[model samples]
Target chain A: MIRAHGYAAQNAKSPLVPFTFERRDPGDHDVVIEILYCGICHSDIHQVRNEWGNSTYPMVPGHEIVGRVSARGKGVTKFREGDLVGVGCFVDSCRECGSCKEGEEQFCTGGATFTYNGTERDGKTPTFGGYSSVLVTNEDYVLRVPEGLDLAAVAPLLCAGITTYSPLRRWKASQGQRVGVVGLGGLGHMGVKFAASFGCEVTVISTSARKEADARRLGASHFLVSTDPSAMAKAMGSFDFILDTVSASHDINALLGLLRRDGTLVLVGAPDKPLEIAAMGLIFGRKTIAGSLIGGIRETQEMLDYCGEKGIVSDVEVIPMQQVDAAYDRTVKGDVRYRFSIDMKSLST
Target chain B: MIRAHGYAAQNAKSPLVPFTFERRDPGDHDVVIEILYCGICHSDIHQVRNEWGNSTYPMVPGHEIVGRVSARGKGVTKFREGDLVGVGCFVDSCRECGSCKEGEEQFCTGGATFTYNGTERDGKTPTFGGYSSVLVTNEDYVLRVPEGLDLAAVAPLLCAGITTYSPLRRWKASQGQRVGVVGLGGLGHMGVKFAASFGCEVTVISTSARKEADARRLGASHFLVSTDPSAMAKAMGSFDFILDTVSASHDINALLGLLRRDGTLVLVGAPDKPLEIAAMGLIFGRKTIAGSLIGGIRETQEMLDYCGEKGIVSDVEVIPMQQVDAAYDRTVKGDVRYRFSIDMKSLST
Candidate 1:
């Protein structure tokens, strides 16, 4: 076991504090990553606070991780020492499952081993995430982070980027299609960038009028203040597709009405409670409401490579590891510009 | 105007009574259909009792119409005298809309003229439906009823048949897919037949255990009682596509769970209220929930031709025109075998 030290939440109510832990020794096909910048995801807040009820205590939570390959076992062919890589939402999945075979391992029937607050393949070994110094995982599960982007900004791309990119790509969003990004936070900002990069005309729909400037600067062609009744009414049946990234519960019927005939609304954010959806809303226009998780390893790599080629990266505010608790509070309040990537170098201080 | 007589609902609470009405005379590009059989839809009850709150007084509710073209104007190119034809949920749609041009006239932005309880193109004239003795509609909105099948059984095909078939084909439920039909009534029965004919492995999901035998008889290979928790649990992620024909608000999250990764659940029936859905259920499997209205005129014609080739028709109980009130009552009670096709000749009584 390798000695590791980082920040962790001692319990559901307490904020994250510095803690020491142990990681499994790198074995064959395993690459140990020196996590440089770990993005504080909204899910991290959810899990650390036990809001999802499945969280384990003394939890070191951070999944959107970008780092350098520090060490590897002899069988690790995908990564060399010092090569840039990323660890996303999960660390392992049942490789034999049909979803794994289809390169959609996130939906593996045997259950995926999440990076933190989750059991590993051994079922007894609890996995600690990138809120720490290092990560040891199979080479197949590690993504090759592309060169030529702000490393800290690219951290959230592992989660926020893939979450938005997968749906737009899966839905066949192409040029001339009108796309709406519902919320201008972590996921929506990326959705705007990627959809615009894909040549789609992007619109950001948000309750806050202040997000309009950032939405436009993020490559969105239009901004629809969701709170304005007349604005929402005029935008009805306008968008071909809508990406809803708001985690807080909102009116989905209004969003459903914004889509044109046969249009789709994809939800990536998981609200704690069930939403009230009218079946007539979908039936009237032959519309759809679909949901997507943060993508598979193969798709993650594709998204990274595409990001490199398209000059796409998430808008992130880099914070010191010690400020993670404050960051969590801000994230909950939607205070950040987009996302927060924790600077791990501050952990030693 | 041509005189017509049929059973009509004077108001929301009243039963149907013998009433006289008038339809516009056949114009150029129009055909006068002498109604032979008209299927009673669950929506007929909704309209007659103002359940949808859009019913016009003295509403004659029936959209699943099949008859002979008794008269045609000189410019009628699509139909000839004495030809069998059908009229579905709508009588007219704005031809220039993108939805109409794409052969999805049901979603016309200009609003479609429903066959019953709706106003005609001129806006002032109220349109009566197929429960009346005759229907004068443009040839473009008329569907040619195929020969070699029981005409009465084909009546429901105009509404119930197309409603199910459209989504199945739209979602591309083809050979090798595992399909589940929820409910065993008008829409589900056809869903089973069409899914089975499409070479998909069809499963009937119903709350009633009594539907098992008839489900298999209707071409379903499997029966799943949705109320059986253990059975439902065992059948989790078992379907590639599910056609939800249930109008009552049910557990959509459970239905979403039945879909495999990327599987879809399409709704044809409109629940009066909004349904509760968990975003996590859909996100976990990347599943979809879509809704479809009835097919457009062109696609309805295609469906008719396909049914002709496949020898498929709804399992219908023929009722006299005067029995529509009873049929509507029974329909609400879920007592009909599949559909109730009204024998219009009984109107003379």
Candidate 2:
């Protein structure tokens, strides 16, 4: 075991604090990563506070991990020392399942081993996430970070990026298609960027007109104020696809009304409460509402390469490791401009 | 004007009574049909009682219409005198919108002219449905009744049959695919027959185990009582597509859980109230919830042709026109074998 130090929440009710732990030494086909920047995901707050009712403590909550290959076992042919890489929401999965065999490990039938607050493949070892100093993961689960992108800005791509990209690619949101991005936070911002990069007519739909300028700056050609009835009515049956990224409960029926015939609405952010959907809204026009999780390892690597080619990176605010608690509070309040990528080296600052 | 006689609902609280009305004479594009059989739909009750909140007084409520072409205008080349024909839900549409252009007149932008309780394109001429003795319809909206099937059993195909068949083909339910049919009513029975004919592994999910033998007789290879928790738990994540034919509000989340990754659940039924859906249910497996109305006219014709080839017709209980009230009561109580096709000739009996 290798001695490690990082921040952790001892329990659901407590704030995260500096803690010491041990990570397993590199096994064959395992690579040890020196954590560089980790993005604070909304799910991190949800898990750390036991909002989802399944938190294991001494939980080091982070999944949007960006790091450097510090060490590799002899059998690790994928990554060399100092190669930049990423570990998203999961560390490993049962490779024998249909999902894993199809390269969609995120939906592995045998259950995926999550990055933190989750047990490893051995079922006895607790996995610590990238909020820590280092992480040792199987080489197959690691994604290669493409060159010429801000490493800090690339952190949220592990979660928000793939969460948005997977559904967009899966649904075939292509050129000349009208796409709506609901919410203006972490996931929505990336949805706008990607939809725009894909040559789609991207519209940012939000509750406030104040976000209009920022939405336009983020590549949105149109800004729809959802609170305005006339605006919503005017946009009804117009969009080909809508990416709903708002984690808070909202009128999904109203959003469903916005889709044209046979259009789809994909949800990336999940609210705890059940959403009320009018079946007529879907039935009359043959509309669809679907949900997507983060991308698989192969898809994640593809997303990274695509981002590198398109020069697309999340708009992130860099924060020190000590400011994680504050970042979590702001993230809950929807006060952040976009995402907050934690500088792991700031443990000494 | 052509004279017509049928049972009509004068108001929401009243039962059907004998009433006389008139229909337009056959125009250049119109065919005059002498009604033979009309299916009693669940929606017929919903509309007569104003449960859908859009009923017009003295309304003749039925769309599952089968008839013989008694006369045709000079320009009507599609049908000849004495030809068997049928008309489904709509008589005409704007013929201009993308939906109309694509042959999906059911979703016409200007609204399709519903067979009953709706206005024609002029927006003032009220329309009546198939409970009447005679109906005048354009050739485009009329379907050819393929020869060699029980004519009475073909009535429900105009509405219930096409409603179920549309979504199955739209979702590409094919050979060896596992398809689940929820509720064993008018729509569900056809779903089972079609899915079975398509060489799919068909499972009929019903609230009552009493329907099992009937379900299998209707072509279901398996019957799983949805009320049984153990049976449901064992079938988790097992289906590729589930045709939800239940109009009553049910545990949509539970049904969503039955889908495998990338699986879809299509709803053809519309319960009045909003449905509660857990985003987690759809997100975890990347499942989909979609709504599909009845098929396009072209597709409805295709379904009719396919049924003709397969020797398929709905299992229907033929009832006299005077028994419509009792049929409606029995339909609400789930007492019918499948559908109730009203014998229009019984109006004189």
Candidate 3:
């Protein structure tokens, strides 16, 4: 067994604190990663607080993990010592399910083994996430981090980045298309980058007019203040696609109104409350409202490659491991410019 | 001007009563049709009662009309006297819009001239629907009714049939797919027939167990009682496409769970309230909830052709024009077998 030290929440209401745990010894098909960075995701907060009602504790919650491969078991031929790799939301999923076979393991029928706050395939062993100093995972689940990108900034790509990328790709957002990214937070920022990099005319739709300059700086060609009724009315039925990234409850019908005929609004954010959608909005324009999770392994690697090629990395605020609780609060308040990545070296200090 | 007589709702609170009106004489591009039958739609009730808040007084409500060409203007080359034809939800649309040019005139950017209770393109003349003795329509908006089908039964095809068929066709429902149809009304019944005729393994999902035998008689191979928890549990993640036709509000989330990964739930019914949807359901499975209005004129023609070839027609209860009020009440209580087609001859009587 490998000794692992990380932050954990003893219960739903408790703040995370230092804790010690063990990971299984590297199996024949497994590789051990010395964690370098872990990006905090909104889901981590949801799980830690048991907001979803399915959480278990003490839970070490992190999934957007970036690290250096420290050891490889004999049968692991994919990576050797010191290779930079990433682990996203899930660590393992049943390989035989249709979704798994189709490379969409996020929808695995047997239930995916979440990186944290979830059980392994055996249904008895608890899994710890990448707030830890090390992780043991099968080579198949490991993604090769492309060269020449800031690793800390790349950590959130596993979650926020892929969550936005998968939908853009699926919806065929491309050159000459008008794309709108709703919200200007972690997920929306990446959406703008991806859509802009794809040669689309990107527009940032937000409640705050303050984000206009920042959105333009992030490669958006237009910014529409969603709170402005006249602006919204002028932009109605204009977008080919709208990537909605707001996690807070908002008016989805108004967003649906922004789509042209046959246009789509893809929801990447999981709002706690159910959305109120008028069928007429969709029916009149023949519009669609779809949702997507983080991409599959192959797609995640593709996203990383695309980001590397486009020089696109998350706009992140790096912090020490001790500041995660504060960062979580800040994230809830939308104070962070984008994402927060915990530098794992802070654990040693 | 041509004299016409039929049932009209004098005001929102009133029932249909005999009313006289006049239609413009056939112009160069027009074909005048003597009405044979008109199918009652649930929307007719909504419009008559001002449920949508857009109703006009003295409204002649019906769109599903099948009749014979009574006269053709000089420039009307598509039809001659005695030719069987049908007119659906709309009578005219701006021909220059993208939707109109693509034959999706129903979504005309300049606003489609609905068969009834809508203003014509000139923006002042009120258009009447098929409940009357005769209708004058442009050749472009008329459809050829194929030979050998019951014209009265085919009346419902103009509205209810096209409403359901468009979504099924758009979703690419075909052989080897599992299709589920919700409810057993005018729209749901058509959805089952279309999906089943498309060589799919069809399942009828309904709240009533009594619908099982009727659903099978409509060519469905499987019937699942939606009210049965165990049945719903067993059928979860089972369908590739579910054509939801329940206009009255119900649990959309539960129906969304019945689709497999990448599956879609298409809504043709317009529930009065906005549907409540959990984003996680759509995100985790890559599922979609989409709305479709009636198909384009081209597609509607194709649907009619397909129905003719397959000998498919709505299972309808024929009634006199005076029984429309009773039919509406029965339709509301789910007492009708599928649809109510009023014989226009009774209007003259």
Candidate 4:
């Protein structure tokens, strides 16, 4: 067993506090990583507060993980000491499932083992996440972090980045195509950067007029205030695709109207309530509403390489490990520029 | 003007009554037809009773039409005198829009002229559907009713047939694929036939256990009662595509669960209220919920040709024009075996 230390919430209503735990001994295919940075995903808050109802207590919540390979078991061939890598929302999946065989481990039929607040395949061993000082993961689940990108900024790519990139790529967002990014938060910001870098005409649709400048700064070519009916009506049936990254409950039907015939509205954010969708909005135009999670490992690696080539990185606010509780509150208030990356080095203090 | 007689609903509360109307004389690009059979659609009842809240008074509701060309203007080359033809849903469309240019005239940006309860391109002339004794349509919008098929039984093919066929073709529901058909009604029955003939493993998912035998007779290899929790649970993630033909508001999430990874649930029927869909159901497996209206003219013709080759025609109960009112009530009660086709010749009596 390897001794590890990190912050954990003892219960649903409690703030995270420093705690000590033990990680499993490295197996033949395992690589031990020294955690470098961990990004705060909205899901972390949801799980910490038991908002999803299935959260386990004494949970160390973080999935947007980036680290250096500190050690590797004898059978691990993918990495050596000091190689930068990442572990996203999941750490293990049943490789025999159709989804896993196809390299889409995120949709594993046997249920992928989430980074935290979830049990291992044995159904007894609890898995701790990247909020800790070290992580032991199978080489198959590890992703090679591309060189020349800010390691801290790259952390969120494990979650927010791939969540947006997968849909854009799947839907074939490309040059001359009009793409709309709904909201300007963690996921939306990445959607804008990716869509723009892909040579698409990008528009940011948001209820906040104040996000216009920030959205433009993030590569959006146009800004449409969703609250303004005239603006929404004017842009109706103009977009080829719309990436809906808003996690808060909102009207999807209005967004459905902005897509042209055969267009799609891809949802990446997980809202608590079900969406209200008018059949006519989709039927008349033969439109689609689809959902995507963090991409497959192969696609995630492609996203990282693409980001490295395009010099695209998430706009993030770096915070000390001790300030995570404050960061969570601020995140709830939408104060972060885009994402919050915890400087794991502060854990040593 | 050509005098035509048919049944029309004068108001939302009124029953269909005998009424007289006029159709325009054949234009240079037009073909005039003597109506033979017109199939009763669920929408016909909805429109007559103003259930959709968009019905126009004195509306002649019918779109599933089969007829014989009585005359063709000088410039009409597609059909000649005595040629069997059919028209569905729309009489004309603005051929300039992107959807129209792509042969998806059903989604015409300038709005396709509906067969009834809608105005023509001029935005003033009311277009009467096949409920009348005669119809004048442009050559482009008319379809050739393939030989060796019962014309009366082919009426429903215009609406219900294309509505189901379009999605199956678009989604590539073909050989070796597992396709599920929800609701064993007009559209569902066609979906079963099309999918089965396309060489897919077809399953009929319905609330009633009694539909099992009928579904099997319609070429379904399997029948799963949707109302049975154990059956639904066992069939989870079992389908590649599900053609949802249910017009009534039902749980879309449950149907979504039956689809495999990257699967789709295509909705052809328009429910009155918005549907409730959980984002997790779609996001986790990269599933899609899409909508499809009736096919465009080109595809409709293709469907007709395909059906001709397969020796396929809708299972319909022929009725006199006077029985339309009673038929509408029976349709609402789900009492029809499959479809009701009105014999337009009864109008003259």
Candidate 5:
């Protein structure tokens, strides 16, 4: 067993504190990664606080992991010692399942293993995540961190970046298509960048007028303050696709009306309450409300390659590992420009 | 104007009382329909009781209309006197809209004229529906009822039949697909019949164990009692498409879990409360929830022609016009087998 150290929530109501655990020795197809950086996602907050009600205790919550491969077992052909690789939301899946065969292992019928707060296939091993010093994952589940990206900023690509990119790709956001991102936070910022890189006319829709500059700086061509009635009314039935990244409870139907006929509104954020959608909003325009998770391993590699080609990485505010608790508070208040990445090197203290 | 007398609601709290109204004189593009039968939809009841909160008082509520053309103006090219025709939920729409040009006139951006409880474009005329003896509609919106279908049973086709058919057609429910209908009411029964006729393996999912025999009798290849743990567990991760027809709020995420990867759940019923869907349900499986209104005139005619070819019609219990109030009560209690059609000839008294 390999000794590992990280920050973990001892219980649902407790703040994260330093903890230590052991990881299994590398198997034939395993690659041990020295996790260099870990991005703090909104879900990390949700699961650590047990706001979602299903979170396991002693949880080390981080899936957006970026690091260098330290060791590789005999059969680990995908990676070698000192190679840069990444591990996203999932670590292992039943390879025999139909979804795995179709390259959609994330939706494995036999249950894929999540990076944190999840039990392994044996149902006894509690999985630790990227908040720790190191991780050993199967070769198939690990992704290639493309060259030429700020490795700290690229950590969020595993979750926030792929979460936004997969939906935009699925919805066919392309040249000449009008795309709208409904927030300007971690996920929304990536959505704007990806959509713009895809040659789309990107627009940002936000209730806060202050996000306009941030949106523009992130490559959005237009910004519409959703609270402004005249602007909102003028932009109605204009967008071909809308990437909704707001995790709070709001009127989803009001945004559904802004979609053009046959348009789609892809949801990347998970809200606590049910969204109130009027039937007229969807039926009158033939619109759709769909949800998307992080990309599959193959697609995640594709997204990384594309982002690397476009020279894009998440806009991040890097913090030392000890400041994670403070970062959590700032994230809750929506104070960050985008995402927060923890420098795991600081954990040695 | 032509004098018309029929049963109408004076207000939200009023019952069916005798009322008088005027029908427009057959214009150059108009066809005067001599109403024979009208199907009672759950929507008609909702509108009458103001359950949807947008009711216009003194309303006539019916849209599934079947009739014979009594008069056609000199310039009416599509129909002549004595031709059988049907009119569904809509009466008119701006033909120049993108939706109209795409043959989806039901979603016209320029405001499609609803059959009843709605004001016309002129702003003062309260358009009456098939509850009356005659209705004057523009020839373009009138559908040609093909030969061989039982006329009374065909009335529901204008509304329920087209409503189910449009989505099935949109989703391409053909051979080698597993289609699940989630309820056995007016809409569910029609969905089963159509999906079965389309050569797909059809299954009916109902919370009530008693609906099994009826589901099988309606041509369903299988019946899954959703309340039965063993049955639902066995049916999970099996369906290619699920057409949800129940309007009352229920757990949509549970049903969404039953969908195969990339499957879709088309909503035909309009529930008042918004559906609380789990993000994992959609993202992991690439599933979708889409809503479809009733078909346009062109597709309604196509549906009528298809039903005519198959000798298919609704399982309806016909009643005299005076019993509409009682029928509405039974409908609210979910007592009807499938649908109720009012015999318009009884309205002469």
Candidate 6:
């Protein structure tokens, strides 16, 4: 066992504070990552506060982990000491399942071992996430953080980046396609950057008019104030794909109408309540509403490489480990410009 | 104007009774057909009762028309007098839109003219459908029904057939795929037959065990009682595609779990109420819930020709024109084997 320290919520109602736990020693196929930075995702807040009601006690909630591989077990060939690597939402899955075999371990048949507040496949050991000094994961699930990108910025790519990139890739949003990204928060920001980098004509949609300039600054070609009826009307039946990143529930039917016939709306943000979709919205235009999780390991690596080539990294605000609680509150208030990556070295103090 | 006789409801509360109307004269691009049979679709019931709340009074509702082309206007090129013809949902649309140009006029940007209860392009005239003995439509909207098919049995193909066929073709459901057809009514039965004909492994999913035999008889390779937990559990994460054809509010999210990762659930039915979908159902498996209306002119014609080649016809209960009210009642109660096709010869009395 290895001693580890992290910020954790002792209970759903408690604020995160200093906590200590033990991480398993590197197994034959394991690589120990010395956590360098951890990006806070909306899901981190959801889990820490038990907003989703499944939070385990003493939860170290973070998944967007970037670190240097500090140690590799004998059989681990993918990573060695000091190699930069990343881990996303899941740490392990039943690799024998068809989905896992096809490299989509996110939908593993036996259910995936989530980064935190989730029981491992053994059903006894609870997993801790990356808001800590280190993490131990099988080499198969570790991602090579491509060279030349800012490490803090790339941290969110494990979650926010892959969440948006998976759907854009699946929906084939590329050159000559009109892609609209809803919201301008963490996930939406990455969606805009990725869609633009993919050679698509990217439009940012937001309820507030203030995001127009910010959206354009992030490489979006156009920004539509979603609250503006005229702008909404003009965009109706226009986009080939719409990456909806808003986590709060709103009228998705209105967004559905904006899609061109046979166009798709890919959802990454999980709303607290069930989404009520009007049947006519889908039937009338032959529209589709799909949802995507973070990509599989192979795809995540591909996304990192793609981002490296395109010089696309998240626009992030770096915060010290001590400010995680404040960052969580700011994230809830939508105050962050994009993402907040915690400097884990601050935990040493 | 050409005079025609049909059954129509005077108002939302009134029962349909014998009525008289007139169709526009065949224009340069029009073809006039003497109706021989028309199938009863669930939408016909919804519109007659104003279930969707957009009905026009004294509405004559029917879109699935099979007939012989009685006359062609001067410039009509696709059809000649005495040609077997059919007309499905839409009668006209703005031909200049990308959707219309791509032969998906049902999603016309400038508004596709519906077959019935729709305000015509001229604004004053209300379009009527094929419940009448005669229908005059632009030549492009009329389908060329192939020879050797029972015209009565072929009527449902115009609506239900094209509705199921379009999505299967769009999703590229073909050989080696596992296709699940939900429900065994007019639209679902057609979905099963078409999927089977496409050389896919077809499974019929219905709430009642009573449908199993009928499903097998309709070329289904297997039948699963959807309400049976063991059966549904066995089918989890197995199907490549699931075609939902029930036009009533039901638990759609439960069915999403049945799809293989990256699989799609295509909806052809238009339920009156909003559907509640859990975002996790789509995200966890990378699944989609899409809706498709009936095919446009070109694809409807293709479906008809395919049915002709495969000797496929709907499992229809033929009835006299007078029994339409009872058929509508039975349809609402889920009492019909599949579809109800009205033999217009009964109106000759």
In model 1, what is chain B's TM-score?
0.99
Please list the residue runs of candidate 6 whose C-alpha ends up more than 4 Å from where it truly belongs after superposition: none
| Candidate 1 docking band | high
Report the number of backbone clashes for model 1: 0
For every candidate structure, what is the RMSD over all alpha carbons to the true structure, in angstroms?
1.1, 1.0, 1.3, 1.2, 2.7, 2.0
lDDT of 6 at B117: 89
Q: Give each prediction's DockQ, rounded to 2 decimals.
A: 0.91, 0.92, 0.86, 0.91, 0.49, 0.85
Provide chain B TM-scores across all predictions.
Answer: 0.99, 0.99, 0.99, 0.99, 0.98, 0.97
Question: Model 6: per-residue lDDT, tens digit, B1-349?
Answer: 9999998989888888998988889999999999999999988988999987889888999998999999989999999999999999888998998889999888887888999989677766898887889999999888999999888999999989999999999999999899999989999998999999999999998888988889998889999888888989999988999999987788898799899888999888877789999998888888999999888888888899999999999989999999999999999998897899999988878
lDDT of 4 by residue, B1-349 (tens): 8899998999999999998988889999999999999999999998899887988878898999999999989999889899999999998999998889989999988999999999999998887888889999999999999988999899999999999999999999999999999999988999999999999999999998999999999999999998899999999999999999998999899999999989999999888889989999998789999999999999999999999999988989999999998999999988887999999999988
Docking class of 2: high
Superposed by TM-score, candidate 6 places the C-alpha of residue A314 at a distance from the truth, in angstroms, of 1.6
| lDDT for each residue of candidate 1 in B228-263, tens digit (9 for 90 to 100) | 999999999989999999999898989888999999
lDDT of 1 by residue, A1-349 (tens): 8888889888999989999999889999999999899998999999999998999888999999999999999998989999999999999999999999999989988899999998998897898999988889889999999888999999999999999999999999999899999999999999999999999999999999988889999999999999999999999999999999988999999999999998999999978889899999999999999999989999999999999998889888999998998899999999998999999889887
TM-score of chain A of each: 0.99, 0.99, 0.99, 0.99, 0.98, 0.98
Q: Candidates 2 and 3: which is better by DockQ?
A: 2
Colliding pairs, model 6: none
CAPRI classification of candidate 4: high
| lDDT of each residue in A1-349, candidate 3, tens digit only | 9999999999998999999999999999999999999999989999999998999889999999999999999999989899999999999999999889999989899998899988989998998998999999999999999879999999999999999999999999999899999999999999999999999999999999988999999989999998899999999999999999988999999999999999999999878899999988888888999998898999999998888888889999999999999999999999998999999999999
| Worst 10-residue lDDT window, candidate 3 chain A | A304-313
Name every residue pair that clashes in candidate 3. Answer: none
Whole-model alpha-carbon lDDT for candidate 3: 0.93
Interface RMSD of each: 0.6, 0.5, 0.6, 0.6, 1.8, 0.7
